[model samples]
Target: MKSAARHAIDLAGFEAKFRAGPDPWHTLTARDEAIKRQRILRALGDGPIARILELGSGNGSNSQALARRALKLHTCDGSASATQLTRQALADAPNAHAWHIALPAPLPGHRYEAVVIAELLYYLAPRAMQRLAKDVANALAPGARLVLAHHQIEFPDNTQRTAGIHDRFINALGRSVTKVRQFRSQRWIVDGYRA
Candidate 1:
């Protein structure tokens, strides 16, 4: 199959697998992430900070955590149901904005204190990756912080190998890459990039 078709199949498989469990992975994953997410959230700083945005705001777990701190928080996802869950979960909270965005598109506006994109990049094809990266980097202010977590390569495959190498290449496209010492279920996290 072509790479794009392969990715589509992969995503379909993911949807079916996760959809098997009606509530999906976000909840259990969030509970597992609770402690480390605290560290990530704290790194973004305790605000009076105006705004924070979370990409792939799955099940609204992490976004809700952020709404507690930021003056205003925006949560976005490509999926309508996911965005709906985000809004519903955050409805009781005051400082929350939730939206369903079509990916590979530029963020609606720039200037945010921090952005979290957890496990979102690999879903895009390589062509889309560059566009997405450009949009993300351009959307940020010079020193705006980004938190990027990836698909856990618990065991490697050719695609995973390419993904790792892609990270190095993408890192160079921006100013610098720094490895963040953190744990999200033994997966790696990278923090702070000019990109």
Candidate 2:
């Protein structure tokens, strides 16, 4: 399917899913999600992050943990309900804020020390993915890191294949992004890129 066509269809599907309830991907209860979270944290290392951005923060489970470590954390999701759930989940975390954003749109105005895209890339179409690559490149501060994690198995709703999604970013960023770490499991692949 074309990028725009797929985006429209997926947006409607996702909106309904978000409206139904948070944790659409069951991140809170899934063992794989937990492992993915741990791997991402490990990839980020033990450095004190001044500011971080988490794209497609589904239910804020990861956001809550990241908020504890960072001085400031901003999470964005395409679904309004998802963002609301994220806000509620991180309500007591003074440093965290969740915003509702449609995919392919511009990121927040501030540059980030670390940007995370976990289990979110495959859902984005080709055009949106290009925009994301450009936006992320522009949004990263000097020596900032971008972590991308995704399920290796293709899903019906996925607009792009897992390898293709990651490859696009690697190709777009080129020498500007350095591969910091990579971990692969039977179900998921996590890669960290520093710019």
Candidate 3:
């Protein structure tokens, strides 16, 4: 009961923060954020991805970056304000599409060449994370890549630790996915997997 209430409060807070400020996380100015984005971009490489789905793309910062490299980019978030901000930020990018959608929900029928989930997994409950892993596997095209990145440090809003989250993700993925690369800094951990 307490957990459920806290979850609702957290979701509301995310929306409120986005409505009040475009850079709720200061992703636009943070050096750590820049480094994390650069590393994810490097993992994506120079090749043009056919389709990319980015979950929890606050203000479309990372989505805009990926839109430049992808033929089509779908960025989604639970917060309406965040989605609106993302749409506004990516308005110039013809390839990007920003939508408001909650996590652990049904994915589109089509598969994607690449999918990125950054700084969002820990917010989901354990069951939701399990469902997400399956959804990610199903949404990936053959030999497609999935990038999972999360903050290593503890935070008040997180539902699970980074290590536990990644462990469950890999467990849920089972033999269907293979890890390709991993990067760890003092602040964050990023892992790339192939399906």
The TM-scores of all predictions, comma-separated, are: 0.74, 0.91, 0.91
RMSD of each: 4.6, 3.3, 3.3
- lDDT of candidate 2 over 7-50, digit per residue (tens): 33376787788888777779898998899888888777687799
Pairwise TM-score winner, candidates 1 and 3: 3
Q: Candidate 3's residue-wise lDDT over 118-167, tens digit each?
A: 88988888788888888887889998888888888877667776666676
Off by over 4 Å in 2: 1-9
Question: Local error of candidate 3 at 41, Å?
Answer: 1.0
lDDT of each: 0.62, 0.83, 0.83
Q: Tell me the deviation in Å of residue 176 in model 1.
A: 5.1
Ranking by lDDT: 3, 2, 1
TM-score, cand. 1 vs. native: 0.74
Question: After best superposition, candidate 2 residue 94: deviation in angstroms?
Answer: 0.8
Worst 10 residues of 2 by lDDT: 1-10
- Candidate 2: residue 184 Cα off by (Å): 1.4
